[model samples]
Target: MARFFAAIGLLNLVIFSTSFLAAEEEVMTNSWHVIFKRDVDHQTAHDVANRNGFLMIMPMLGSKREYHFMHPQVKSNRKKRSIRHTKNLKLDPLIATAVQQAGYKRSKRGFKPLKSLLDEEKPIESINAFPPKKGSNEEDPLFDKEWYIKNTGQAGGVPGLDLNAEAAWAKGYTGKNITTAIMDDGVDYMHPDLFDNFNAEASFDFSSNDNFPYPRYTDDWFNSHGTRCAGEIAAKRNNGICGVGVAYNSKIAGLRMLDQPYMTDLIEASSMSHRPDLIDIYSASWGPTDDGKTVDGPRNATMRAIVKGVNEGRNGLGSIYVWASGDGGPSDDCNCDGYAASMWTISINSATNDGRTASYDESCSSTLASTFSNGKPGYKDAGVATTDLYGKCTTKHSGTSAAAPEAAGVFALALEANRKLTWRDVQHLTVLTSKRNHLEDPTAHHQWTMNGAGLEFNHLFGYGVLDAGDMVDLAKDWKTVPERFHCTAGTVKGVYKFDSKNALKLQIDTDGCRGKKNQVNYLEHVQSFITLNSTRRGDVTIYLTSPMNTTSLILSRRPNDDDNKDGFNKWPFMTTHSWAENPRGKWILFVTFSSESEEFQSGNLFEWTLMLHGTQKSPYTSQTSPLIHNTKSKLALVKRQHERAAEFQF
Candidate 1:
């Protein structure tokens, strides 16, 4: 809501060494960030902040445009809008000048009214914005959206939810017009398969509002993850297509909410507008853990907006919002906490392709038990079948990050089936139709204890895994009816319900432990059933760990600050260019051009800090450094082969 202005200043571009050589003249050997710093002649910094035109145009390999940021010297117009950038190349230079005029001093300071060159030779003003063009070396076959949709070359073909089958059989629905808003880094809007499905009218980067998200393949971060997620949500039905989507015909809308600082406000703003009938489903593959933990912190702006939308969403035209439960759990005191599954409004859990649960899946370990998304490893809840942006078919999708969208795709199908169903109704029906693990209970332990039954509501796996067919059937007879129930731990003596007359107090006691390790035994079981789908390497072996005994879970990323002038640092003590190389686990190492020097600067903020992560062997390390000034700076995670990226980590 705050306006900003422009002020011209002297410009200086900072360059960084690249793994690939730049075009000679534009190269900066030991520098990062091709910064352009200029000064405004007479205009004050606040002036530029007001118009929100300030742009800092250094080349980014990922999405084409950037959410331009004001040079630190500019007025305090730090809201996301000020940092907006666009993919419309024609307008890049003009916007660049307006951008420079806003802050950077590119040339003589007595600036004249800038005329857009877009009208003459290049027309960037009216150019249809999209993600950025790929760099020459960024040869990711995943750029071909159709390839992934087919699940071609993937680890294994992705499996459709049985519930999807049920819905298809009954409703004959394929999500023709329902719109899904994917909240993540910009998606490949122009991919042939995705282009047909994109609802351009509904798409916008609330983070910038003025520009299209820069989606390029050259930057590893800007790879096809978003496209893959969208494919899972609503890839077109077999037109001889490679992959299948939950809602084959749903309209997919791309909203760039991630890849920025303080995305909450932008996300909230997007939800507050006109309830476009087209957007009946808002699928956010990003969020913080509600459990007040470090990695997953308190509710951010986007979350508050979602909650608001759920309660009073868009003039009562509330959209179904689905979230991915995290893969962080199965660890000590790790609960499926916050935004993703924080409230009844949000659905949470992991994916399972073949019914086999893995050791890393973040289970429906919340107050409400939800369905287990199909992971790849059958019988072992590993991952849902998915296409990698890089065009690889993953036999076992490895993260809840993958599972959430798959579920969202299913939710979209339900919307397509019943046009009148509201979010609350959709959630209830999902619960009702979910297949309880206890449907074939083997014994008392697996008796679907706290889980909800069509007959009752349970906590672990809310009502159990959602069935697409059941949802379709319910949509046929849709109404605004919601599940009304409470959990009394059914025969499990440890979970007790208090009388309404007293204050709200939660007292968990393991006093019923008959054996010395009964408490430990129980936790291990929970971890096994739920958190198994996260990483592929680890076995579900809980070592009698609890939050009390746990130290800290630290995350690491590639080094962003090579200067080391500021305390800015990467996560793990050591990083490597080669996967097999042993890291010092001492000094931070980044993706330098090579062994030319011990330290080298990365091209930019996002580029340098990417490709880093922590391991189960060391979930966290004591050493830490963000921007010395504040937390919430852009942080990337280097990923291990078996484990995918974390949504909350960024």
Candidate 2:
């Protein structure tokens, strides 16, 4: 690990853009981050930064005191500073110097060290796009071509393993009154099939800070990805253009954030919370690079945004977040992704048209369910058909990226069936209505394990393909789940060192969960925060076993990942494999290094923490403030209508 670090500098604040805007006077624009020592008063820190130079201040979402400050670019007179571009200047040295000159002394309890610094970290994004097959020029043309919607055994697909969207539409649960925000590149809302269902008020362009979240002229390569994804959710029905969406009556919006040159954590947070009150679900088809390497997740601000949205969005019912597990089947594991592995989000994987798992799916316990997307490689099966940019239609959408929106669309139908369902209720319905043993692909794994709750789940298929009809039907009579309950095993502070060929095992007993104020019998999601030192991160694999003997392979070896630039730094590994498992008894975590790998011979498990999320037997008033929107989603519709009315009068 030390050698790897010497080879690659720390993965900290990275400057991707060549240009930064600065004004002559009154500070037009500046980008810098400050993390004060613990116990620093918020007002004092803000005043200090302002006195130095930072004028625009915003609190970092996750941290209690960390603040991100920016200076505006004024057009008029400005005093000159040596640092002209925010990207070039490292603010830490200047801030430290300024504080020292001001005779600011460190707190007695605070150790002597540099606590504040610039936040410049950037995250990588990989998009999913497959070659599209041209559709026929006929009425309701592409409907028959969309095997993912209704297989009919077309192109080697199974007859009934599709999402059953046709049956869902037959029941009149077409996602009415539901709005989904696609957090990706951009959506071609003007496309004929998407224009009618587009919701402008629910959309925003975080990259450009504009109201219209459409693809710009600079980047055509990535623009169509979001549009195709949106088409899978709410393309206009009977449009005579493209295939119908799973939830044809649902409203779709776009939050353009990923197409920019630099994808900073701050920008991602803005996108994650864009009009959460108006949008029911935030669909994300993009994540860290799927190169069978990089292990990364949302930074502080983004993490805070996700938590905030799930707790407060939808007028307090909570916003539903849908994430693609990943497309790195050959090597990567979805557990490495913080977003998909989070308990607050629904992680979805892709299945082929024939009901088989996609070849590129990264199997992990974090995945909750599967949905139809593209077909297996070297096979004649067809991929999904949906609208694209330039006012056209295509059938090339594939990958888990394509599968997540399909799941989101199903949830939209469920939401339409029962508007009062909370985010947790949506997850329950997903687990309940998902079908097992539906895929017919010969190459895919077919193993199924019956969980303690009598529900069967497979890592490859994630409780099997989503059943749109069944989900909506269940939603019709779904009772709101009891309030969420959590239990924690205090931090393990010891460093257990080990060499190759030996496994490190640690156990914790719940004692019928007496420690928890609320008794928990079943589990929803389990998370482990681990800090480790490994010679080769790619050679490490971790597993968690529940008392029921269900073992989840949470961290798989990634051969391409050689550097631990961040050294595990309390990284979290989560699993949904324990759903409905007895929360009492013993839970074990096993960490191991591959003996077969001669290079990775040694490592140390520095620290670990365990957390459990589920429900109690009886309902109690939730400590979390109820976020129920008194007016509900209808408020957004009314606003949209008013905007259209004002536009028409002019």
Candidate 3:
């Protein structure tokens, strides 16, 4: 095959010349990220980093005048004196954007330790011979192998599929004063079931810049992936040592920022704005390399620290982040992962203790739900029993990195049963208490459709699974879901082409912005953005649809993306499968190409807009009872309370 594509083009030019000489020796000895000019204050950007010999080093946590300096005679053989000190700190008129830091690889969506029964030395009461059931006062012993917190189907799973988390721990909602950070790679927080629910002042260690986010030990423990996603979110109940978490009195922050030798955007904007006012659920489970040809995401100060941690973290009642919708199964396609197709990250995905799906999940439409992980290959005790590294224990934490800390421990038991739940009221109580229980999609491509408002989605398990006692019983009567707006609705602009048998189809029409200040009736996250170019950008795909027609396969088909040079530029591409669906008139989109040998697929698009998001009132009329009678049988009792809040069945 032409000498096997010239030995895969000389092993991709020696792995791109050893990752461009280790990113030019870590940008000639690290630390730069400047950005000053908001009237450059902080002691005039600390006296212009001590008049340029630079040293400063801190100021960036959650940005806004950014900082991080360091110079000291630029090392690794001074790459042209670190490109002339980043071109004289961007020709400093009080600098406004400097950079230098460059690493980016991420990956860790768990799963590589197969050959199971966790290499057997049995004990944990000989792998579950029944016993610990009644009232289940869990003296840990791997809490009866945690069948994702109460599945009861022992090992073959499927009994009550799971995570009703003991009916949200029988309503007391154990996540007291919720915290949950665990960004990844360094948490073992002295693991005695995560040492008294570890929140060492909201932990730090942006990879050894330290304040002990622990886990560095080696011999293949491989930094126990943020201590098994911090024991699946705060492991410390009656802690006889191993299982029990999913908000077992939640608090666990340990943002070690991945065992670093790379990954940057100021270390993912300082582990997503570090203590977002004491971290109420960051979670992350690494991203980008699900490898169906890496389309990556989040750059530029980790997209302004996830839009300043969802518009001014926690104090603004926002910071919920959560991610990991990528173990790239079906040949990778988490909307080509821009941080799990970010609408400010919630993403999740990965069902299994019998709810199916997880063979490394990743089927996109911007995920939104699904939890539990470990299953499929031979299934014995399936996997994911938490805490490891030194204070050891593990039923081998499987992927979607153990399902985004089990949906950040069921959103820390719905933020401890609603300590005023807002990051869009925990994404509208995870799309009105996520449920379609027995997940599915066992290769039946992604089934459960239903959108134009009668909810039920699924591009590989979304609007489903995660039901910590029905999302803490609809986050204790949620009501905090109005305000968010968005609009845009239509655009299109210029260049359009097609291939693999024509197929381009576009149309817009919108009214979602009708008389506007960001109007948008009902739909929660639509996005679309785009910009395209293709010719084999993983044989394109796209889709969209809804003016209540609901199609939405918003970008899929990344069969090992054969990048034909930087394709999608604007690239937003989100979709909650048109959530409440009423974004005014006609909207179709298509774009297709999943190549069936048309000799040279194709693409182009160039632009598209759409946007929409929701809430101009009626989040089901703020959970009803405004003395009901708004006629037409109160709009059929708010469409049966929006189909029992989309089947959460209150």
* Best candidate according to TM-score: 2
TM-score of 1: 0.49
TM-score for all predictions? 0.49, 0.76, 0.33
Superposed on all Cα atoms, model 3 deviates from the true structure by an RMSD in Å of: 22.5
Top model by lDDT, which number? 3
Sort every candidate by TM-score, greatest first.
2, 1, 3
Q: Write the per-residue lDDT of candidate 2 for residues 1-650, one digit (tens) a residue.
A: 33223112211211111011111122222344555555355676677566655643455544545555555552222233325434222354333221110000101100012221112111112111222234533345678877878877777767777888877888889999899999987898877778889999989886666788888753223466788889999987654666789998999999987775445666677778778778999999887667666666776556667767767788778789999888887478888776688777899988887666666778888899998767655553266778877677766567787899999999999999899988888887787668774654355444787664445788777777888887777677656777666667446778887768678998877644554554565578887778787777777889888887888888887777675434465676888877755666778889987535566467788777776767654111211112113222211222233344335321
- Score candidate 3 by lDDT: 0.74
lDDT of each: 0.37, 0.68, 0.74
lDDT of 3 by residue, 1-650 (tens): 33233323322322222211011233334678888778455677778888877877678864448788877666522333367788888887878768677665677886464333345412132222233444555577777778888888766888888878888888789898888888888886765667767889988887667688787776556677778788878887764667788788888888787776567677788788887888887888888677787765776556666666666688877688888888878877887777787776888888888788866677888888888777656666578787777677777677888888888888888888888877877886787667787887766877888776667778877788778886787677666776767777778889899888788999898888767766777778887777777777887887888877888788877767777766766767788888766778999998888865657677788778777777666676556432234443222344564656445311
Weakest lDDT window of 10 consecutive positions for candidate 1? 3-12
Candidate 1 lDDT, tens digit per residue, 477-594? Answer: 5545422211111111122222212211221222222232211111101111111111110111111111222111111121221222221111111111111111111111111121
- lDDT (C-alpha) at residue 410 in model 1: 69
Error of 3 at 451 (Å): 17
Model 2 misplaced regions, further than 4 Å: 1-138, 218-220, 378-381, 440-446, 564-566, 595-600, 618-650
- The collision pairs in model 3 are none
